[model samples]
Target: MAVGAIGVVFGDIGTSPLYALRDTFAGHHPLPLDQLHVYGIISLMFWSMMIIVTLKYVSVIMRADNKGEGGSLALLALINQHTTGNRWGKGIILLGVFATALFYGDSMITPAVSVMGAIEGVAVYQPEMHPLIVPMVVTILIGLFLIQSRGTEKVATFFGPIMLFYFATIAVLGLVSIAQMPQVISALSPHHAVEMFLADPFRGFLAMGAAVLAVTGAEALYADMGHFGRSPIRMSWLAFVLPALVLNYLGQASLLMRNPAALESPFYFLAPDWFQWPLLIIASLAAVIASQAVISGAFSVTQQAIQLGFIPRMTIKHTSTAAGQIYIPVINFALMIAVILLVLVFQRSSNLTAAYGIAVTGAMLIDNFLLAVVLFKLWHWKKPLAIGLLTMFFLIDGGYLGANLTKIPDGGWVPLLMGIAIFTLLTTWSRGRALMRQGMAEGSIPLEVFTKSAHSSATRVPGTAVFMASTVAGVPSALLHNIKHNKVLHQRVVILTVHIEDVPYVEPAERSTVKDFGNGFYRLTLRFGFLEETDVPAALRTVTMCGEAFDMMKTSFFLSRQTLIPSDKPGMALWREKLFAWMLRNAASAMEFFRLPTNRVVELGSQLKI
Candidate 1:
């Protein structure tokens, strides 16, 4: 698992040596390739990794996992469970959602930037290869996305060893360069970083923006924790990944100190001429693996968001029986388009850098905020201690965020814009769902009243009819519509309400609560962990109190399809209501999302305004 963490969890940060230092000197925010700048930037990268990745995430944040699951959403759910249920808790929830929105932006840019940075090595091999760089990156990216449908486990089995090799190779390469310019090792001192910043505050500050690239994928340590577990990821990072990355950055700095012109491409130049091509090949593979991790994270986020009701359900195809190995065609194709467009527009890795760090830094800041919440409210840490720890984290994250903000006009706006757009959609969907429930609740009838009074009033049909509802107490809008239109109720009416719990996984024993409401009516409330997929028919088989076991062929599932009409009623803005309506129009049908038997499902449409 430690080895696998090397392959999947650390890909983005591991590959940073490929362009991180190079961009510091030659990127849009260029700095002098002198010893002061070299030492300062190298020192900044080293401490950023130690402080941000090691201290904040691995030590503090990873401990905040939600039922062994880690990520912004999972963490949000966990924190939401513990915090004040007033507007303050809602505010934190919004922050977490926006962090998730930032993640989507990061997800899109990671593939484009990481892959392009790796392929740009060809330019070092031969400057004439510049024109082919974009095409090669585009081809590789398209191929990567195209193969996402076919799960990565088979290929991922070998990822650990391959990435281990890549890390070892880079470490060795760094050692060789450090040997030639041993003085570069002195840059490890915090003094150099402070001195350089003091010497030229503005340039050092701007360089801090590019230096952030070193720890770009640090969040993955938390995001991908579920895949490899906390122990493996932390062990891999502390033992191997951190050492290799630090050495490589120092080596790049050493190479620059010896010959300033090496700033053109210090990573490639650090390699012996004969080994450059092999290094490039290994680097490209690492980049693809890094991109793979981010892409998979995107899929996981989409699944979580849907289950948590932040996004509309999309067609989710489980590519493997292995837990969390799933695919969403809509998300896949959409990401592919966004990634390709980013590559085409940015053209070079240096340009992409301007857009890269903003999303990550923003996300890191949000994580710290969530972590503070966990410490005070959930972990029951002393306020002073929690405040002190949070102060330190804020200082580091705030500095990085401030640095990255300087890039907004250059290209940082790309991810910022994307984050805003996604955040809007997510908030709109959530608010709209709340308003929807409110509107539905207005006309909802209690189960006892409906069953006792209406059972005798309606014609009875054979077999069971399951009416899906948002709440267990009320008569489902679908049932109301169905009875009003058809004027009949089935012999057995199951008022089924699926409750997505805040936790990640619920035990089968605790997954359902069945109540016999009497008179051929059974109120069934199915509970699922937020991470668990919902399958109505499957869970229904567990119902012994329903008289007989459920048979898909004999049972008919009824779903309510609400046609949302833009309203002047007190709620969201007019535009947001329209946006929610559009999103609803495109969401996957309930039958598909809940894994119900398609042939046994019936849709009853009703109009609602919020």
Candidate 2:
């Protein structure tokens, strides 16, 4: 598990040595390649990881996992359970959702930056190969997305060993350079960072934007805590990943100190002539691994959003029998296009790096807000300690965000614009779904009342019928439409609703609940955690509680497909209502989403306005 965590979770931060130092010295806000700046940047990078990744994420926030799951949505789910009715709940929820939106922006930029950053090493080794960099990056990234449909289960076995070698190689390179200039190790002290800020606060502030690149994937540890437990993640970080990253940064600094001209390619210069080619190959592989992690993270986040009702359901394919190894074609295509455009427009990793800071820092800042909720309300930590911690985090996160804001015109706007667009989609879907549900429920009859009245009027059929509902209390429109049009009810009638819980996994023992409504009417509620798949047919097979057990061949599933219309409602604006309507139409079929038997499935459609 520790090795897996190193391969999957640390790939992003592990690969940062490629460009973190180079960007700080020669990025958009270029700094002097002198002793003070080099030391200052190194010190800043080290402390940033300590404060942001180690202390904040590993020690503190990982404790807020939602039933062994972690990430903004998972954390928000945990907090929402406790603060459902509080006035502050809404704000925290929005912040969490927005953080999720910014993550989409992060998802788009990571592949572009990481692949280009490593591939550019070829350009460094032979300047004649520079023009091929963009095409090579585009080809590699396209290939990566194309192969996602084939599950990573087989490939994942090798990730641990490959990443282990990569980290060990970088550490060895760092140690060799540090042996030549041991004084570079002293720059890890906090005083140099303070001195840099004291000397020129503005440059220090600007560089904060660049320094944050080193910690871009810090959230992955928390995001992937459920994949490999916290013990393994913390073990991997402190015992291995963290030290290797810090050493590589220190090595890059040492190289710059010896020859300032290495600023153009400090990372590549760390290797000897014979080793440079191998280093490039290893780094490029590492970059692809990092990109794969980001792509997988995006799919996970999208699944969570759909389960949480923040996004419309799309086609989700389980590429592997493993729990979370799923793929979403819509998300994959969107990310591929966005990432390709970013590469084409930016034309260089340095420019993409400029755009990268805002997306990550913005998400980090919002996470600070979520942590405030965790500390004050959930954990109830010591007041003084929580206050001090929150204050420091806000200042650091805010400073990074503010500094990155200055890069808006310098490619940073790419993420900000993407974040805004994605946030609108998320919030709109959430709000629009709420309004739609409320509208649909307004005139709906209760299941118990309807069952007592309607079972007698409709003719009883031979087989069993399952009608899917959004709520347990109300009758599904599909049942009404079926009874009214055909005037027939199955001998065994099941009114079913699938409820997505706030937790990550609902135990099979507590998965289903059935309430008999007398006669042939029964209400069955299937509960699933946000992270779990909504495989209805498979879940039904284990249910002995619903009499005679579920036989898919003899049972027919009925789904209500709502045709949304733009209404003159006060809940959402007219334009948003139209957007919601369009989204509803394009959403994946409930039959596909719930994994119902295609041959035994029926869809009943109804029009509604929200």
For all predictions, the C-alpha RMSD in Å is 1.0, 1.2
**Residues 24-47, candidate 1, lDDT per residue (tens digit)?**
999888988777888888888888
lDDT of 2 by residue, 499-553 (tens): 9999989998999999888787888889999999999998988777777888889
Error of 1 at 319 (Å): 0.5
Model 2 lDDT, residue 418, Cα: 91
Local distance difference test values of all predictions, in order? 0.91, 0.91
Global local distance difference test of model 2: 0.91
TM-score of 1: 0.99
Q: Which stretches of candidate 1 lie over 4 Å from their true place?
A: none
Query: What total of clashing residue pairs does each candidate reach?
Result: 0, 0
- Each prediction's TM-score versus the true structure: 0.99, 0.98
